[model samples]
Target: MRAHPAVGDCLLALSLLFVDLLVLLSQARQHHGQPWYVALPLDVAMVAPVAFRRKYPQVTAYVILVLSVPHSALQLGIGSATASCVALYTMVVYVGRRQAALYVVAQLAVAVLQMWARWAPGITLIIIVLIFALCWVLGEFVGARQAYHAEVEARLHLLETERDQAGRIAVAEERGRIARELHDVVAHAVSVIVVQADGASYALRSDPAVAERAVRTISDTGRQALAELRRLLQVLRNEEVTREPRIPQPTAESLEDLAGRVRAAGVPVELSIEGEMTGLPAGVSLGVYRIVQESLTNTLKHAGPGARAQVRVRRAENLVDVEIVDDGAGKARALVPAPDLPGGNGLIGMRERAHLFGGILQAGPCPGGGWRVHATFPVRLDP
Candidate 1:
């Protein structure tokens, strides 16, 4: 059979029942000689509240106190007074300190009056007071430990919530970073491909040799763009990073090859290098390459017929500078003085790339009928 939750408590309360029973049977002459039935109910009332002392300590104490009056006045057993002492102990352990203090004071005052009425000796009264004081101190110690455990649990819950919040924020930031990388890779390649396809279509009948070269350039640019796209998409997989060999990103050395492809697309391109390309940080190299690549792509799309482009790169002791100018049909599309608010994805992506590496971009229309993009960055030794 399953034991009940209150079984142990009932057994304790039953022990006190025997104490009052023994008083009634062996010490009947000490009272006014009341019968067993008359005194039985009074004894039961006193110990009944003991079973609920821990659940309702203050209520139990008050109930025991009220019951004691008739028990004491009618010359019944002292069970009610004894039960109140157990209530006092529970009060300190479970109730607030102020309530415990109030009950304790009330108990002591009644105890003193009882001792004085009985004319008990000073030593006996002192012993009773000492025993109650010791129980009170023990209850206070248990209360302290209970409060400490509760505080620790509260702090642990708060820390767990903060940890989950930080993880979500990190995931959101990684997603944004991936979006920017995809835009830079796909936008630049698709622009070059579109321009080359147009040139190939027009030159197919009149200039067969030029058309063939544009087709080959388109094929090569498409393959390179595909490889870069695969690298960016790898971040989404759950596999370990080492599962695939890493691909090197494009740097400043790739600019000449890039300009060659743009020239192959029918635009006149002139590339110039003003400073040493060595000793630049990896991020700076990548940022510079993307900036130049994107600016040239924009010129191919926006610059009108008979347009020519120039790319200039200069490295200094503290910074690296870049300039791209195109003399195309500019007045038709107000490419200069780009709106303070970003005009398109191309403009927004360019600014994001520059800002990622502590750089600044200036883009606007040139008075000579074209658009120009200028950017500069601190040549960081370490990323």
Candidate 2:
């Protein structure tokens, strides 16, 4: 229901002009001898500047104060006092207190000169002071309220920005976690299936039983990979929360079964544990298991014929250590560093897992003609 500022100001100026016209007509009817020519010009000049009071507050106010001097000397009717009060209020609200104080002083000086020149009553001065004081109070109250609203709006905007930033950061972290999980599941299973398929292709003519075993291994590996994939995809669903039980994530104790699987894929993995791994935190246990899993999977894919790996896990009082080493017999040349290659994130994914649990991982060609990966994570045993 609020109008534009300029339109409102124009309407206010016109209303004041109409009131001044009525006052002039009344004075003329009462035979005060105020001529229309002089009084009409004075009234027009007084109210005209008010239309632009908010746009050029200080200038409009000063112009009105200057004109009030002549209007008072000429003994014009109530229009002079009304215009001065409006300008004073405008200055206080739009300009500021310090400037408005100066305007009030100038206005008081004009009032005193007019009263003395006319020998007006003391009560007249008292009424004028009260009216101007009222205007000043209104300006102060409105100005303070506006400032409070502005401050509250600014704070709300800042809080909204922080909330949006936090949401984006959380989403990015979840995506990275999912990517690592997918890479571990898909890469390990596909490598095993490819190796078994190649072995089956050749053993079908020489040994039917070995071929059948390789085919069976391929079938099991595929099913396991599909189940892990489905579990990962479920996390991305947006359906209402349900109480469906989840498959438990593999931990450090599951490394024995992992080693047996790698041995079936033509890479013999010897796993050794030095200390108790019981009651380890879920995140730390998962990290240790993944680091070993990725290392042995790399050996299966790149380590040449006759390659064998050793996996050692040591759980200490405040930390867990994992080391995987394989004799480098992969391909004619040692496996080329694939860190920058597309679809080659085995090392990257392993390092990310370790760092997520406050750990460090190192992977490279060992000095004694093999590949070695070592990782250590800090953890506290649960009582």
Candidate 3:
């Protein structure tokens, strides 16, 4: 029988006490022994502690086993001693296996001595053995259930940890992409603004009209910068639908417009092209446009007043070469290292953009005291 405290203990205690007293009365009548009154109180004493089997299982089991010997010796009811079996079974099922086994051995010894003292019947001995077996089986079943629950809990915990790790990895990847976009937008816009501001400042006293043109370029560049920034921030905030209502991006064909703006700022720029430039990929074309834009802006800032810049683009079978050279005595002045000038993040940004498309960029003073920027990009016009 399963050993549980709620229903099992109460039922077992009541049944055992009633059966023991009834059996004791029948035996006393047959042998002319003591009356039912005396055995009834003793039987109640034996079954009373069974109720506490779950709360203090080992202690209750031991007490019931010890008391069973004297109750059986006194020829009390048969069911009075059976209540101990229920308590012992409760101990084995609830307590640990080692303690349960020790309890079983102690109960067996008490049973043997009681049976010998009164020469108990065969049926009574068989009942005791069955109780011991039942207790062992119940103990094993409960232990298996506990182990299964633990295994399930451990697997659940492992899956939750993996889920959290994946979420962190996703967040890190998103942050990296956002950082690259911001770098591209800010670096290009800031480079253009710095160049136009410098040109306007230089032309203020001698050529007020040229200075006014440079200031207009500054305002246009600022507006473009704000638009790009808004696009990036909208993406960050997950508002992509609203940003779709904004202006489209500038492409390779827009290079002439870019060159016109630089010329309007009072810089003289000569543009030349070679090979079939019509079929370059969008990414490569955008890269070329940005490189040319940044190079001309740098010329305006560092090449001094009245400097001349040449922009050349040559396309071959698998590669494109771009060169921006300025012929001016301003190279020495640009190299003088003005502490107030912005740091070299613009140059770093250009190099990073080139490297991303599998290209290389070189910028420095030429042997004849001019500044030259040369870049090479691999191009795939089609898929």
Candidate 4:
């Protein structure tokens, strides 16, 4: 059977009571002759209340004081008076300071009256009061110290919890940023490949030359997309590596290669440059490349077979503008059913990549029977 808390406390109180009683008996035996019935019985009555001292400290203390009177009156064992002193000490230690103080004054008065009536020594009264005062002060100091330590520990625990919460918030924010980057990379690449593949598939049966070009376009687009994906993964894996190798990244300079691939996919792309293409930042170049790739890919998928596409890159004083327009009918049957392009995350990716370069992208069906994608980036590169 499980023991209740009170039962455990009672058992400890009993054990203390036994030790106190044994000490009292031994002291009495060593100093005084064997006591008569009055002394022995009175000593037992004074010490017995100590067993319940923890449960009813004030009551036990008062009972010991009351019983001390008769035992003293009958000239009982001095050791019995010592047992009453032990009970008084227990009360002062366990009970509140205010109550213990009041009880101490009452017991002192009683002790004084008894000693006066018997003509006891003045030195003994002074010694007994000094002992009681010392025990009371020590107990109060220990209790206050325990309470102070507990408060400090509670505050430290609260601080640790707050620190953990802040760490979790930071980690969640980082994950959100990483997810956005991944979406931009995958959407732009996949959208372009799908459009090129569709155009190539349509030209395969009728035009052998066009069909071969389309196949080559699809292969090149797939390879470029894979390289971009690998670069992104590498950056994520070794985040602490401050310096990166100067690997070649597809940028505006590579537009000719991009146009060649798209033309091979059976979509003829006419490219035009209006401004000097010098001293462009790497990030800006990459952004421009992705925008054009996405636009041409969309043309291949939505413009249908035999679509003619136009790509223009114009650099002004503070801005660079890129525009792609296609003459084929807008969007294939699958894209038309779901204008948003079901399960396609391309358009969204393009916009995000453009935004990263401090630019804006616009893509939709033009007033004419075709589609257009235009992007503008703020130029920050030094001339």
Best candidate, lDDT: 2
Which is the better candidate, 1 or 3, if ranked by TM-score?
Answer: 1
The weakest ten consecutive residues by lDDT in model 1 span 333-342
* Residue 71 in model 2: lDDT: 72
Clashes of each: 3, 3, 1, 4
Cα miss at 12, model 2 (Å)? 4.7
**Candidate 3 residues 1-383, lDDT tens each?**
45544577677788788787678768877886556677777788788778777788887888777777767677676644566667656666678778878887887788877778778787877888897788678767876887788899999999899999998998876665456556655665676677778878889999999889888888887887788777667766656756477655555566777777677666788888787667787767777777787778777667777888889888888998889888776547447443233336656656766787899888776666667778889987565
Over the stretch 224-289, how does candidate 4's per-residue lDDT look in tens digits?
Answer: 667766665665566533466534666788888878766755578999987767678887887787
Those runs of model 4 whose alpha carbons end farther than 4 Å from true positions after fitting are: 1-210, 231-249, 270-285, 305-322, 327-344, 354-359, 365-369, 374-379
What's the lDDT for all of these models? 0.80, 0.84, 0.74, 0.70
Better of 2 and 4 by TM-score: 2
Model 3 stretches with alpha carbons more than 4 Å out? 1-95, 205-213, 235-383
Task: List the candidate numbers ranked by lDDT, top first.
Answer: 2, 1, 3, 4
Query: What's the CA error at residue 378 for candidate 1, in Å?
Result: 3.3
What residue pairs are clashing in model 3? 20-77
Off by over 4 Å in 2: 1-22, 33-45, 48-52, 66-83, 105-109, 112-138, 240-248, 274-278, 330-344
Using Cα atoms with residue i matched to residue i, what is each candidate's TM-score against the true structure?
0.76, 0.81, 0.53, 0.48
